[model samples]
Target: MAERRANVWLAAWRRAVLDRLPRNREDAPWLWILAAQAEADLSLARRMAIVEVLRDGRPHPAPDLQAAVEDRLGEGCFGAQVEQTLEADITSLRAWSIRIGCSDTPGVGGYYLKDPIVKAMDKPGYEEHPNPMQAQIYRSMGDARKMRSMFEMFEFALHQVGIGTRLRHPDWDDEQVEAEVRRLVTGIEPTMG
Candidate 1:
C-alpha cells in the first residue's frame, strides 16, 4: 500500500513538472510514468534527459529516441495500434506544419510549434491520416538555438509529468496551423496566413 501511494505521489509530481512547461496544458500522466520507466531502465537522472539530448543540438532521430524508449520503458511501451496512432498524430502535425510553411526543425520555437500542434491536433481526419515523408522533414527543421530553448521549456513543463501518447489527432488540419502562424507573425504576407 505504501509502495502504491509512493508511486501515485511520484506520478503527480511528474505531472506537475510537465504542466509547468509552456503550452503543455494537456494532461498526459503517461509521460510521467514513461519518465520514471526511462530513468529506471536507462539510469537517467531525470525525466528531462530525453529532451536534453534533442535540444542540445543532436539530431532528432526517431530511431534513437525509440531506442531510448525501448531501453527505459521496455518493449511494451506501446502496442502496434497505439504506436500507429502516435505515428499518425505526429505525421498529421508534420503535414499541417508544412501546409502552413512552419519550420521542420528538431525544435521549432514556442512561437510556431505550440499553436500549430495544438490547433492541428484539434482538427478532423488527422487522427488516422499518415502524411508523406516530406512532411516529416519539414516538421523537424528548427536550428539548435530554437530547439534547445523549446526543449528546455518542454522539459520544464513535463519534468515529472507522466508521459502519454494521445491516440486521437483531434486537431489535425492545415487551415488551423496556417491561421495560427499568420496571427503570430506581424506584417507577414497576408496570403501566407
Candidate 2:
C-alpha cells in the first residue's frame, strides 16, 4: 500500500516537473533523471521543514503545521495534496529514526518530536566556547542561513566521500566509482550480477 502511494506521488511530482519544463528541455534524455533528483531534494526539504516546525517540542495542531510547511516550501509547491504529502514526509522522517508523536485525537490534538536532535554547539565540549553575544549573533542568522549551511556541509561531506572512494579504487572507471559512492552514502548494496 505504501509503495502504491509512493508511486502515485512520484507520478504527480513528475507531471508537475514536466509541466514547468520548456518544450525544448522536455525531450532531453536526462529530464527524468533531473526530475528524480529534484524530487529527492524536495522530499528532504519537506522533511527538514517538518522537523523545524516541530523543533520547539510543542504539539502543533495539524492545520497549523500543514500551513507552516506550505509557507516554508513557498506557494503552490504542495498543490492541493498538502496534507497527504505532509503525512508522507512525516513517515519518511520516522524511517530515518526521527521520533514524531501524533495526537490521538484526529486533527485537533497535534504533533511533536519525541526527542529533538541537539546541535553540536549546544553540547558541552573542550573546544572554544562562544560568548553570550556571539551565540545570540549566531542564532539571529535565521533559518535560511542555517539550511544553506547544512546543505553546504552535506555537499562537502559527499564530495569528500567521493574523493576517498576514487582514491581507494584508482582502477575503477567514473561510473564504478560513482556506484560505490552511492552505495556507501545510501547503504544500498548493488545487486549481484
Candidate 3:
C-alpha cells in the first residue's frame, strides 16, 4: 500500500510538471517563478515574493544577482542566479522537498507549485486587452505569412504597435506597407481568437 501511494504521488508530480509547459512557454515571469519555486530550500512565502517581483519587473541579469539576493534574502548572502541554486534544480529540489514534507499534491503543498501560477498568468494575457494598441497593430497584420513563422509574426506585430521607431524605411511605398499590415491581421486573427 505504501509503495502504491508513492507511485501515485510520483505520477502526479510528473503530470503537474508537464502541465506547466504551455504557460511557461507563454509567460516568462511565470516560468521564472516555477523554476524559482522548485527550489526546495526556499520557503513557500519566499517563492511567492520572488514570483511577484518577476511578474512585475525584468529578469535578473548576472550583475544584478546581488540585488536580487538582497531582495529575497536581505542584503548579505551568497549565491548564483536563483535557478542555479541547488534548491532550484529539479531532481535535488524535488527529492529534498519531499523529504522535508512539502506535499506533492497541488494547493496543499507548502510552496506554490508551477501549475497554478502558470494558469493564473495565462488568464490575463488572453482575456484582458492590457495593451490595446499593441493588440490592434498585430491584428492589422494579415495572418497566413505570420503563422508560417512566429518570428516574422512577432516582428510584424511589434512594428505595427509603433515600437522601435516610427518607420525604419521612410521611402517604402504606402501600398506595400498596407498590404503587409492586411496580411498580418488576417493571419493572426484566427490564432489569436
Candidate 4:
C-alpha cells in the first residue's frame, strides 16, 4: 500500500511535468497517463526547484524553492500555502529519489539531486508553455482531478446529510432518507420516485 501511494505521487509529478514539456508527438489524449504511471520523477514543484538549483550549481534555500515553483506556476499566488507545499514536495522528492536508487548529496545547503535524476532534469526546457495540443491535455488532467475531488467531497456531504435525515425521520427507509438529503444538497429532485 505504501509503495502504491508513492507511485501515485510519482505519477502525479510526471503528469505535471509532461503538461509543461513541448508536444513532439500528437499522442491520444488519455494515453499520456499511462506514460506518467510508468516513469519515476520529481513532482512539478520539486522538479522546478531542482532545475533552479542545478542551473547555477548552488544550494537553493526553501524561500528560493518556493519562489521558483510559484514562478513556474505563474501568478505567484497562494500566499502561505506555497511555503508548506514546497516543504512537503522537497521532503517527498528527497525520500522518493533515494528509494528509486538516486540520492541527494548530504548538506543543509539545499536539497540536491544526484545520479539519473539529474539527467531527467535536463530533459525539460523549463521556460515555455507546451504546444496547444499538450496544453489541452494538461487542462484535461486538472479538470479530472477537480472532478474526482468534488465527488469525494460530495459523498462525504451526502453521508452527513443522511445522518441528519435519519434524525428527522426515524421511520423513513434508508433510500427515502438519502433521497431527501440528496434533494436538499443538490437542489435536484430525486429521480427514483
- lDDT per residue (tens digit) for residues 1-193 in model 4: 4235445544565567567766743444554654453343325434544454445444556666555554444334324576676656656656666321222454435544443334545456775556898667657777778788779899999889888889989999988887789987897756743
Candidate 1 structure quality by residue, lDDT tens digits, 1-193 = 4234334544564667787867653566667666577445322322233333333333334545445534433443434554463344345545645222223464432112233233444546645656668567656767875688667765554432212211132364655444434433332334532
For model 2, residues 1-193, the per-residue Cα lDDT tens digits are 4334434555665676577767855586576785566455666656766787898776788778877766666654555787787788888889989999987664337889988565657656764666899678768888999899778887787688899998988999988887778777766656656
Task: Give the higher-TM-score candidate: 1 or 4.
Answer: 4
lDDT, candidate 4, equals 0.57
Q: How would you encode candidate 3's per-residue C-alpha lDDT over 37-140 as one tens digit per residue?
A: 53433344233334433342233343243344345444323344544542453334345453222244532233223422323364565656568887777688
Q: Model 1, poorest ten-residue lDDT window?
A: 160-169
Task: Indicate the residue-level lDDT of 39 in model 3.
Answer: 42
The top-ranked prediction according to lDDT is 2
Identify the superior model by lDDT, candidate 1 or candidate 4.
Answer: 4
TM-score quality measure for candidate 1: 0.24
Name the runs in model 2 displaced over 4 angstroms: 1-40, 105-108, 117-193
* lDDT (CA) per prediction: 0.44, 0.72, 0.44, 0.57
Clashes of 1: 34
Quickly count the clashes in candidate 3: 15
Tell me the TM-score of each prediction against the true structure. 0.24, 0.38, 0.22, 0.30
lDDT of 2: 0.72
